[model samples]
Target: MPRFTSRPLAAAVLAGILTPAIIAPHAAAVDYGMDPDVVQNPADTPNRPETSGSGPSMLTQGSSDGTVTEGLINDYRPQTVNPMFPEGRDHLPTADIDMDPEVLARLAEYAKVDGDRIRQINAYSPSMGRTIPLVWIVPQDLSEPRPIVYALGGGDGGQGRDNWITRSDMVDFYSEKNIHVILPMLGAYSYYSDWLEENPDQGGKQMWETFLTHELPGPLEAELGADGTRSLIGMSMSGTTALLYATHQPGFYDSVASLSGCGDTNSWLGRRGVASTIYNGNGTPEMMWGAPNSDYSRYQDAVINAGRLAEQPNLYVYAASGLPGDLDFLGPNAPADDGAWDDRRGPGFYIEAASNLCAHRLKQATDARGIDTVYYDFATTGTHSWDAWNNALREFWPIQARGFGIDGGSVTPGLDGEEAPWVGSSDSSRYTDLFGPSSEIYGGSTAPALSSRLDDPSLSSQSSVPDGSSDSSGSSGSSGSSD
Candidate 1:
C-alpha cells in the first residue's frame, strides 16, 4: 500500500485556497437536463435553500458561501458519542423483518415493464427509522437464485427507480444473462456513506453504507432470490462511493467498477472538489465526515485505502480525458452543433478529467502494491456524461460477468485485446505532476505509509481469487431520503 508520512497541514490553507474556486456564485442556469429520467428540471422543484439549494454554489448566488469557520472546523474533531448511531449500539444493527408488503405492493404498480420483472423493496434502516426504496430487476425465469449486480445512479437527488430501464439497456442486458439487478434510490448527493450528522439538504439520516452492506442483503436473498455473491458498479458520485465501500469492506463485493469517479478524497484538490460538491448540493461538509483533513475524511479516502481493494478478485477503473471523442456525439445527449458545448460539454469534460486524474492516483497506489487483478481503462478523449458511463457498463459487463460466475453471452469485441493503461509510478514526482509540488496538495515530498501490511511480500503473494460460492453474506442497515 502507498503511504503518506508528512505531518497534516493546517486547515486554514483549505479555507483560503480551496473555498473560493468551490463557492464562486453561478453565472448561468445549472443544467440537469443531461438525463431527464434521472433528474428533474430545477424549475419543477421549488428552490429550498434550507435543504436542497438552487444549484452549485459556484453556479448560483443564493447558495451558502462555501466557507468553513473556526467554530465549524472544530466540529470535525472526534466526538465522545456518534450522534447518527443509536446509543449503546457499538456494532451494526440487523433488520428484524423483510420489506414491508405494503411498500412492495405500491412499487409493484410501477414494475410492469416489457421484458424483465421489476419489483420494489422498502429496505428498512434502523439508524434512520425509515425505509429506503430499492428497485430490483429480476429476470423472468425462476429456475434458480441468480448472482446480483448492484448498480448505483449518479448524483441527481431524484428517485432513480427507472434509471436502468430508461438511462440504458442494463435491464435487457442483465435479464438476458439471468442476473438480478439492484438499484438503490440514493438521493442525488448522498455520497452513500454514514454521515456524522443528519443531512440538512437531503434530510433523513445518511447511513447508506450500513444499509447497502448490512441490512438489505437478507431481504434481497430471502424475498428476491438473490444469491449472496454480488458485483457493484456505480458512476460519477456513486462511483466514488462504490470504490470506498469496496475498500472499507474487503470481500464484500466479488467485483467493483468505477465510472468517471473521483477516488482520491484525501488529497488537497480532491478534498476541495468533494467539499464543493457536498456544499453545492446544500449539504455541509462537517455533517458528512468533518472538516478537511479530519480523521473520518482520511478513513473514507478510497486512494488511501486502495490496498484493501488490491485484495479483491476483480476491479474495473475508468475515466476519460476532457476532450471530445468520436463516440461523444453518438449518445442521446450528444452535443448540439451550436456552442452549448462551452457550458454543457466543457464543464463535464473537465470534471471527468479531474476524476480521471484521481483514478490515475488510485492506479498508482494499486500498482505500487503489485495488485494484478485490476483492469483500468483510461480514454484519451471523452466527457463526464451518461453516454460514456453506459458505454463503459456495456464494455465492462463481460469482465463483471466472469467475476460473478455468469457467462455473459456474445463477448463484446475488442475487450480481450484491451490493455490496462498505466499512469506512471506511485512516487512523489507523480504526485507533483498531478497536483504540482505545492505543500497544499502534497503535504510533503514523501508518501505516508497507507498500509504496511500490503508491502509484505508474503501477503502480496496470496491469491486474490474470490471464492466462487454464492453463500457468503455480510452485515448492517440504514436509510436516507433524496433531496
Candidate 2:
C-alpha cells in the first residue's frame, strides 16, 4: 500500500468508485468513537469542578471604595424580572426575520446549519464589501421580542474550519437557550476593529467595528423580533474585540464578556498577541490600526478605556491558569515526544498564561474605577480550550440573562455537580440607561425607549435648542433622540 492511502480512498469514496459495500467493512472496524450521543458534550463536561480555593467564583478584588467583581458572572438570585419560561419549559426555535429578500438572495450559503439547532444566514456587509456568514441561534418560540447575544468566534476570522462551532459544543449549548445567539464569522485577525486600509490578505476593507455596531444592527434588528437589548461574548482573539466594542459603544450592549483575551492592546504582550494574530493571517498592524504607539493605538486599548468600561453596568472577564486540565487532549495520557504538546499544548499553556495576565490587568483597571458589575473568574486549572470557555459561558449566562430583560438561564452548583438549569432566552442583564430611541439605530425590532436624562433633577435648566454652539446635548436631547 502507498504511504498515504487515506486521501485516495476518501477521494474514491466521494467519486462513487468505492461503494458502501466496499467501505462498510473497513469503516465498521474503525472505532472512531465520535458518536454525538456517546462522546461527552463539551457543554456538559468539566462537571466535576473541584476548586479548592474558598474565594468567590466572581473575581473580587479590593478597591479603595470596597469589593469589586471582574468580568461576566451569574449572581441572579435578583428576584425581579419575569422569567421567559417556567423552570422546565423548553422553547422551540422560531423566527420572523424580515431581512431584505433581494439582499438575502445575493448571499451564498457556506454550510447548512446542523441538528436543526443552528440557522446559517448570509448577508452582504456594506462595511466589509463582501458577503458575511451569520449563525443565528434564534430564540426558542417567539412571542414578545427577545434580546440578542452575539457570541463571536476566535482565531483568525476562521475560514469555516476553525471557530466556536467547529471546535466547541457551544453552538448546541446556546441553541437550546432562549436568547438569540448570532455569531458573525468576521475579522479573522483584525481584532474586529475598523482598519484604516484594507490588507489584501484580509480580502478587503475591514470595517468590522462600524459594520457590527452601526451597519448590521440597523437592518438586521429591523427584520427581527429582538428587544432593543443586545450583548456580546467573545473568546481569545475576539475576546478583546468584545471588550472594545462594548467599551466604545457604551449603552449599546447590555452586557459584554471577554474569555481568555487580553484587555491592554497597548501593553507589550497585548501588542505582541495582536501583531502575531494579524500577521499570521497575512495581515499587517498598520492596515489594521495604523503605526505603533499612535493615539489611535491607545484609543483601541481596553485597559485605557477601563473608565469607559467602568460605566458599563454588566461585564464578564475570564482566563484560565494555562495548566493542563481534564479536557486538554495532550494531557497525562498523551506521549511527551509526540510533538503535539510542543505544537499545540505548549503554545496553549503560554497563550493562556498571557491571557491570565491580561485578565488581571482588566480587573485592576476596572477595579481602580470602582466598577462593580463584573462577574469574573481566574480558573486554577484550565487550558486555552473550549472546555474552559464553555465553563465560562455556563457561568456567565446569568449576566447575559439579566441584561436581556428576563431571567432563569444559569448553571447552578448541585450536590451531584454543576448543571445548567436553563440556557436559552430568559436572557438579559440589568438594562442600563441607554441614550436615544433604538428605532433610530435599528430599523428592525425596537429596543426599550430611551430614558431622558433631562428628566433628572441633576441637570441645570438649559436651552433644549441648537444654539450654534459646540454643546450637542441640548439639541439631541430635545428630539427624544441622541448621538
- Per-candidate alpha-carbon RMSD to the true structure: 12.5, 19.6
Name the best candidate (by lDDT): 1
lDDT of each: 0.53, 0.48
Per-residue lDDT tens digits for candidate 1, residues 312-351, read 7667776766566655566665656555455335555556
Tens-digit per-residue lDDT, 456-480, candidate 2: 5543322121112111111011010
User: Which ranges in model 2 have alpha carbons more than 4 Å from their true place?
Assistant: 1-116, 329-344, 409-483
Clash count for candidate 1 is 14
Error of 2 at 229 (Å): 1.8
lDDT of candidate 1 at residue 251, scale 0 to 100: 71
